[model samples]
Target: MSDQVDVVVIGSGINGLVAAAELAKAGWSVALLERNDLLGGFIATEERTLPGYLHDTYSSWHPLFVSGPAYAALGEDLHRHGLEYRNTDYLVTASVADDGRTTLAYRDPERTAGLFADSRDGEAYLAAVNGFLKIAEPFGALLGSELRSPSTILKGLKLARAAGIGLLRDTVTSGRAYCRREFHGDEVDHLWSPWLLHAGLSPDHAAGGLMIPVLAATMHGFGLPVVAGGSTGLIEAFGKLFAELGVQVHTGTHVERVVVEGGRAVGVVAAGRRIKARRAVLASCTPTALVRDLLPRDAVEARFAERAERFRYGRAAMQIHVALSEPPAWSDALLGRIPLIHLSDGSGSTGIACAQAEAGLLPAKPTVVVGQQHVLDPSRVPRGAAALWLQLQEVPFAPAGDAAGELDTSNGWTRELADAYATRVLDRVAAHAPGLAATIRAVDVVTPVDLAAHNVNAVHGDPYGGAGELDQSFLWRPGPRGTVPGLWHIGASTHPGPGLGGASGHLVAQRLLG
Candidate 1:
């Protein structure tokens, strides 16, 4: 049987959902297809550990989505469809050093600055945030718009006018260099460096010069937010919105190929049936998937196909969900209040861990992102129990050796290996939160291998989709145009890199609507 739609969106991730919703609202008939029995890709929640204890299976934070252009356009509409956010006011985020010294950033600039030992560092942090805000509009423009779009040039001009050539000069500078120059002491650096890991980058990576300050400014501006229930709340709202708009959502149906006729994506073969797209086809998939597996060999030029083949995915990552009997007894009183805390000494420690992971070694002391969701929304856990959302962004998908030289890497991410690594990570957390080991009810570990199995687009368990390196980002995001005429790429693998921003989807929808 054959069916027709104005647009056929493959993969019901954030990007795909955004595109489908936007198009459907704009008077287009859309079909949202997914391979899994459920939608939302990694943006899902489940009782992974125990009944009644909800956990975000993958991405739990909503900083990017809350502040992104897609949210700006769809936020009101989504909120009307049963979407709710549980956010913090003063105690936003904090980082703990190996020495047990904690660096905290709050919603208020003055309050956050006061946490630094050196008063000058506090002043410096505030100044840096203000300085970035001066050029944030244009900077956000560059990030939000397509690299090849004329608006990018206009935004570039606005940025140059606001910040001067000095801003452009730092494009090649590493994040570590930028942080060192901006802040006076390790306290400020320690607080923001590990955040680079979220952007699929390390402290030493290029473009940190811009990202480091921008991230700080953004956090201060729009403190981290989470769905009231879990990450699933956001997608579930989208599902409701889609249904109201009459969008045909086909879950558990895989698109075997993006059929191309006359050098354009005409339709897709899914469920052993050809579903024709009357307008455009948007793929929220990896460049490799779109170019090699889906599209015809001649759909794109040979050169473009070669570039897709060479598309590099960033380091592997893992998520560990810990069901606690009660709230952790943090060593620091201030840390217990903060919702999100990083158990790392800042740039120095995270840099070493990234280096080790890149060298195919399990980082002996990996950076552990301890997300205490129960701090803000008590609904996630039952009664007094707390849920811990631990994220390890720096890990090797296929380990060649262990940095601590204790684990057996010969088996490569086996169940035993994943459990051992989770134990090590939990030990790190236990150092900061005494008696954490005893309070644990259950542990669910999603290793790099497991991440790949869950979402093939992750490509070797890279949650960010692909590398956010200077060359691979912006204009060079696997090239400016899609492989086929009527085909479009709107996912983390595309420009603007990863995260829940959904920038790529918003951009494609705007173009198509225009």
Candidate 2:
């Protein structure tokens, strides 16, 4: 490999991969470095439980990627290199309460609204989603671009004129409040409230009112898509594209520090070798890590470093993969066909769980994200068998105690504790699917500690980089331009916060290329 390149990208997450591929395609020599042996950071697929069941280890859905500008740029290339997606045309997702009431969401908004009890709620639901769609282009552009840029200001102005005062008011209102004001029925809240967790927000958090409509519009427009074979298929496709573009990939290479001279980032010292970067060095890492560990103390201002130190992380997360002997026998037979379902009862229950997790206690009834990947892609499991990708977003990294007071929290996230929590989550699922416990052949649990150990970017087991509070989001988010010249920052930690969007990386690459 050459000792020098046009750009040196640190970390091989979705952000790093996108930046490297885009730059290399633009005829710039790029080198991508990864600490792990594998290239994909969070996106991985493995047979966690049984040989035939292929499970997405971390993130599964791709609604954001399919709808983002990154996909608009690279989707054709990725598809050419063996990237295929499986999506349902009708049933996308649903939510079920303990009382066996199921609220379904379809690809068609009118069809989904028809399921609501009150006809007014159906009308309100349609209005909220369609209202957002009218300004979706400008809103999406503002989120995808550099927030502090002049172009962003114009986009925001355009959006304000189109959306009026309601958009501004919704930014500060909580999802709970938005649902209460918009619709009398609990159906809309029950279906979309749990989705806030995916954005690193709670049902009661600010900006959720805005996010709920965005989520509804996205799911309805794109549908929930998973890669054809596994989530790793996207990574494999990127690998093929990288090779075709002549991008150098160095896996198992830990970049120790950025080499700065004359207040400019010239390269990185990885594996005790100094590989020079003639153009730029993009670090796909947490702001704290970039300011504290990667760069020299004198490279950045002290206040910036201190602010990075204060970068708060939200609640921890856990993944439970279950291999079922057969499909779960849900009490509501319709639930068996939905791609994803949440065990939540709107803000009333989900709010309590978020509060408990923040207070360092295990939630008694945590919002469970049940993903049925096999329903969209039958190749994920053996014929006549199934698997469940269960996600627990409302979890404490270090539990003070269990809210149910059943598990021992003396030891933080030990194997026994994780197993006990897994049992609780499964029991919650079993409530909706009476035969769930009986159908399980094997269960593999990935606790918060496991998440932290697996990916350095997942600080404190927060897979979304950092907390997405109003203070840390939008114009306040860290931009690509760092204090040091030729250094850029991208990833979940940057603006356009988390999810499978890859917006941060795409934004940074466009900045460099322009």
Candidate 3:
């Protein structure tokens, strides 16, 4: 292979794949380099527990990707390359409390609202969602474009004129506060509050109020989708598209540094070889890594480097995959049919767990995201067997103590600690599903340490890139461009934050193409 290309992408994550594929399709020679032996960064499917059980090791849902502009641009190509998705037409998600009370959401917002006990709250819920949809176009434009660009400024102005100052106020309000002010009942709060964790925010965070509506409208519109067979099918499709486009893919090759000359990133040194980039070098990595390790000391100003240094990571996360002899017999039958369910009671419980995690203590009752891929695609498991993708969002990356006061954390995520925590999580699940423990054939626990080891972008076990807090998000996000002319950034750390959505990569690719 030639030691040069039009672009050198320094990671094979979803963002990197999207950028490389888009550019290559536009007739640019792109060389994608990855430090790992695999192409997909966090996107992987494997049978961690037992044979014949395919589990999405990390991120499993694709609602963000399916609804984003990246899919609009590449969905056809990916589908043609053997990508298939399975989605629920009705029941999308639900949340269950410890007392067996359940709140559900469906593809029809009106139907979901109708299920609420207080009729006034139901009306308020519908109104909030409808209000968001009116501004969704302009809001989406700003999110999918460069925040400081002229187009983004115009979009912001359009949104302001359309919604007035209320939009700004809602953007800064906490989800907990929004729920309290808008709805009288706890149903709305129960259903959407725990979702803030998925955006790397606590219920009390500034942007949760806005994010709650976004999540609600997104799920109601797109429904929850999981790639057929396994999440890796999406990656496999991307690989096929890359091959057909003649994009050079170099896995197991570490990019040591960006070779900058005359204040431009001309190439990258990967595995002791110089691979030149004639157009651009897109580093789908954390800002911290880009400033502190990848680029030369003088490549960027000291202030920018310091800002990167201060890029904070949110709470850690853990994944527990369970292979069951039979499906979990949830006490509430509705939960059994739902694709994903949250074991949270909205802001009341979720807030406390977030606080515990932030204090460096393992949440006693962490929010458990129960993902049942087998329900949507039976091919994931054997004939009658099932699997559970249990995700723990409120976890301490380096626990100082256990909130339950039952596990020792002095050694930091030791196997014993992880196992104990896993038991705690399973016990919580068992409370709702009495027969859960008996049906578990095997369980595999992935700690925060494991997550950090698997993906470099998962800095300190923060899977959603860096913290999605107000200060480091939106216009303040790191970059699609640096001081260096040809250097660019994408991935979870960049604007539009983290998700399966390839927005950041698509945005940067469009800019380069333009």
Candidate 4:
């Protein structure tokens, strides 16, 4: 196994697979390694309770598919490999009250505004949609995009100008406080903050608050689309493309360490076997995981070590997947047909998300984002049934008071916590779909522990490798002057930051070959 090759890529996550496929397509002999039976890190699928039902493990929606001249270079590869997308129109924002669920935002933003037009503030909140888009339109143009310098702002500006008047000015100020001030009810704030989280922003945070308008603006332009199969299908599709291109993909094998000589990565030792590479070794993981664990600690910089020790990473969510006997009955016919619905509970959904990530405790009400993928593609569930996913933000990863954020999943009550959260989510679903609780033929739970156990790449179930902070992006990521020549990274944890778009993978490929 220590034989020479062009490149050795550790981890079979989407970015790693895509990078490997691109390298192989470019005529380089590449080998992709994974520790689990599955190939995707967050992109895998499962059928936990029942035999036939399929559930997306992590990501189910991707509207901002990476497309541009950079991706266009792949040519027929994209279409031929079954990489397809479909859109839907459904946004459900509810306010849980003693009376009943007051759906703040139902059909579209206009319809939602109409619901909010009771007072002057409410009417203003509703009417602000158009004015909000004034800013959102330009931000959408940069989705999963490459950063441009001041000289290149014209490219982005040209796209915004194409959107029409007023949109650019809206971009100048994100309507966080504006929406809060205008909307008389907290429901309106709940309605918009989830959109901000979709953009990798925290709802309560300032810079993050601006993301709501941007998310709404992006979705307003491009519909939220789910792939027909499961999220794993995306990874499998990439793997199939790799197979056709003759890339070597080996699963269930984890690389123990990188064989570095004179500060240059030359090979890898995995499963007690050594495999040498001729050109480079790329890690589809966080820099801390790669350098501290795999390389000689003496070679790493003191600053990187210090940052790794203190950088915050409290984000961890548990997913509850249920296969129901019948589709949950929602009073809103529109929500039943939409692909994604956000359940705010009581507190601002975005606030709970950010707070839990910092405090590391379950939010009292627990903000959740629920997805019924079957709404868009019925094939995920069995005939005459629905596949549902409930994601909660409050599940703790490691013990809160631990010296460094270390999560020991070996504990007992973690599952108890997951069970409690899962029941509440299921109850919420039961309200929407009567008899859903009784019809739970099969139920599967993915704890932060299970996720990390599956692949250390996810590091405590933080599927997102690094903090998706504004400061730690673009060339500043892993610091572009190449940590080591012939070495690179492109994944959820990398620049252009997380989620379905293949921007980072495409960038890494272009960076190496371009």
Candidate 5:
């Protein structure tokens, strides 16, 4: 590899890959470096549970990615390079109460409305969907644009013109408040409230009211989709495209520090070698890492450094992957067909779990996101076999105690504790799926501590980068511009928050190229 390049990307997460691809497409020489031997930061698949069963260990869904700007620009090239996505048909998603009742959302809006018990709520549901569709254009633009940019102001003006000033106040309302004001049924609230968890927020969180409608419209517009083969399929395709673009790819190399001289990031020191950057140095890292550990002490002003120091991270999360003998048989048949179902009971259950996690206590009943990959893509496992992807979003990074007082907290996420917690999660699933316990061929549990150890960007096991609170988002995002010149930030920690969407990467590339 050359001693210098036009850009040096410090991480190989989705954002890093997207930024590198876009910059290289614009004819800028780029070098992408990763500490882990793997390329994707949180996207990976493996037979951890049992051989021949491919489980998406981290993030699996791609509705955001397929619908975002990055895909609009690079989808053709990525698809041409062997990135195939498999999606469900009618059943998009659902929520199952503890009593075995289900609330489902279908691709057809009318069909979804039919699931509602009350006729009035059904009509209200349709109206909400229509209202969201009316404003989705401007709202999406605002979410995807740089908050400090003039285009953002124009988008806001367009939204205000379309929806009126009242909508602006609605944007700041909590999710719980939005549900109460819009609909009068528990069914609708139960169905959509759990989705806020994906954004690293609870039902009581600020800006959740704004997210609820968008989340509903997104699911109704684009159903949950996964890679054709496995999560690794998309990353492998990215690797192939990166190779073709002649971007130097370095894996398993630790970047000790970003070299700063004369108040600008000129290069990065990795493995005791200095790789210079002529144009820019992009760090797809948490603010904690970039400001505190990587940059020189005098590179950033003290006030900015203090703000970075106080950058808060949300609660921890864990993953429980199960290889099943056969597909789970749910009491409600609708749940059997849905690709993703929340075993959250309802919004009340979800709220309690989030509260418990934030308080440093292990929730007795965590909202279990039960993902059935085989329902859409059967090739991931053996014939007639199934794989369950369970995401536990409500858990502490460092446990203080268990709310149920059943597990040991003194050890701090040891293997025994993880296994015990995994058992509790399985019990929750078995409540809805009668044969789930019997069908389990193997189980693999990953605790929040395990997650933090896996990726440094996942500070304290916050998988969405950092908390998606209002303060850390929008114009307040740490970068695309940093305190130090020639430095930029892109990743889940920055604008537009988490998920598989490459919006941060796409946005940063546009700015650099301009």
Candidate 6:
């Protein structure tokens, strides 16, 4: 009994951590293993940026800040955990056409509406948000409720209730349709379109995608907040819980393979050692990495592997972080707040950006996100210095005409690509913030290939697991079943898409327990 435990989880990312945490909370001992030198998939920190600067290597904003059960459950009361979130309540969104028309979304929607009073769309903004939230009520319940019931009679009722609420139909429409029908402004639509990226689809595709409001509600409920340190803080908080719970979180360990016997997972093999477990095995890695590399081919059904391969991994990002002496000055007060920014001057920019990789066009003006992390959390940057992350879409995982385009881990080109991407952000932001570039002291960049090489969870450089479209949802996600009697999967790649909410992790674990 001493040699064995209740469960063995591979990868210390949020999915693995949460699965372990949930099981341990239920009085089960667990042994969690991470291949990487550290824990937390994308919610990680890197000192590589500079000596004192701590950059959230992947992401800083948690759209599910309010609605995510992980944060909601964890609450502000860390109880000696030393974790706190400071929110930047202003969204400085602008369209850089002949006229740089910028709109501000305040913590207060009414105030956000004031910035657009002259525009008809501005007046409708509040109402549209209200309507979206109103429609979201039932949809929220549908996502939260257990879709499975012991009896078919109960399951039928759940289905009926969901369909009656118009959830079924709306979820079957594209994001473009949803936005066109709900909001009446160009910028509002531009602002709302970011949600489509979550699903890994262009707004134009008739892919039956309508999950924008859930994301909006999550962000609105709590402005996309970040801890004072970085994303690593969130992951470390879980590590702390694992320690208190006595769950063994081993770092710097590489899991070579998943140990399976008699048609069921038994444990894992790492560092030429076999760590056996009696309870169960949970894989928090990518479907491809888990199946192709970690697990034996025959152990996992070929159909499952095929499905995992077929799954669409969404848009790639070319990211850059600048260690600046001063905040970039903008055409407007972009320095004031706003975690994410959008572009607005294309026929179907949202959809076009989504299809750009396939179409072979590096968009003239791609969706650019300007996240001034140091502005929101000063602790992340060195004293008298700031860190700004600027990421552009359409930077495909496998770009054409590049030798090391997809997951380029071969040469020194990754850091170089990162630098080039950073320069673009500096220039674009400088377009409005004329004085911004002059203040820059140092820059750190992470290209699409860099992201994939670093985190096995984000295959093909897509940060949000698989495509969050209608085709890869709920039961259809990854593969069949929430938990396969002895196996479990969780993370941003799974159902409910990515972000800090850890709601997917909670649901996956809850499903296992239930």
Estimate candidate 3's alpha-carbon lDDT, on a 0 to 1 scale. Answer: 0.92
C-alpha TM-score for every candidate:
0.98, 0.99, 0.99, 0.82, 0.98, 0.87
Model 5 Cα lDDT, one tens digit per residue, 1-514: 6789999998988899899999999999999999999999999999888889999999999999998999988888899999999998789999988877788889888899887888888898888788889988887788778887776788889878987875767668888888888787877789888998998889998878778878888898888989998989989989988888999999998888999989989999999899999999999998889888889988989988998899999999999999999989888877878899998766799999999999999999899999998899999999999989999999999999999998998989999999999999999999888878889999999899889999998888999888887667777767767578988888988888788888889998988898
- Put down candidate 3 lDDT per residue, 50-124, tens digits, no spaces: 889999999999999998888999999999999999999989999999888999999999999999999999899
lDDT score at residue 27, model 3, on the 0-100 scale: 99
Global lDDT of model 1: 0.88
Consecutive 10-residue window with the lowest summed lDDT within model 4? 401-410
Question: Which residue pairs does candidate 1 place in steric collision?
Answer: none
True-vs-predicted CA distance for residue 146, candidate 5, Å: 1.7
* Model with the higher lDDT, candidate 1 or 2: 2
- Scored against the true structure, residue 459 in model 6 reaches a CA lDDT of 72
Against the unseen true structure, what C-alpha lDDT does each candidate score? 0.88, 0.92, 0.92, 0.63, 0.88, 0.64
Candidate 6 lDDT tens digits, 1-514: 1347878877776657667887787888888888787887677677756788887777677656446555555544342476667776665333343246665556667766666544676666665566666646555544543444354345445555644645555577676786676556565555556555545556765443355555454556567677768777767677677777888877777889877788777877878888787767777766767667877777767677787768677767667767777666666665345565554442265566556654543444456666777767878877877777766656667554322243332343456545554554466677766777778777777777778877877777777776666667665665213323466666666665566566666666666677
Distance from true position, residue 103, model 5, in Å?
Answer: 0.4
TM-score of 4: 0.82
- Write model 4 residue lDDT over 1-514, tens digit each, in one string: 4367888988876667666877888988888888787787777777766877888777677665533323455525755777665566555334433234555554376666666546665466544545556544354445434454453376567665655544434333333564554456665565666555555445544444345554554555556666667766567567678878877778888888888778777888888888888887777777667667776676556776665555344366678888888887766565676666676643355565457655655444455677888877888887998878877655567635322233332453377656765776677666655666777777778888887777675666665665554555443455322455556656766666666665566666655666
- In model 3, what lDDT does residue 337 have? 92
Better of 5 and 6 by TM-score: 5
Residue-level lDDT tens digits of model 1 in 480-508: 25578888888998888788988888889
- Candidate 6 structure lDDT: 0.64
What would the C-alpha RMSD of candidate 2 be, to one decimal place? 0.8
Q: Which window of ten consecutive residues has the lowest lDDT sum in model 2?
A: 475-484
After superposing candidate 3, which stretches have Cα over 4 Å from the reference? none
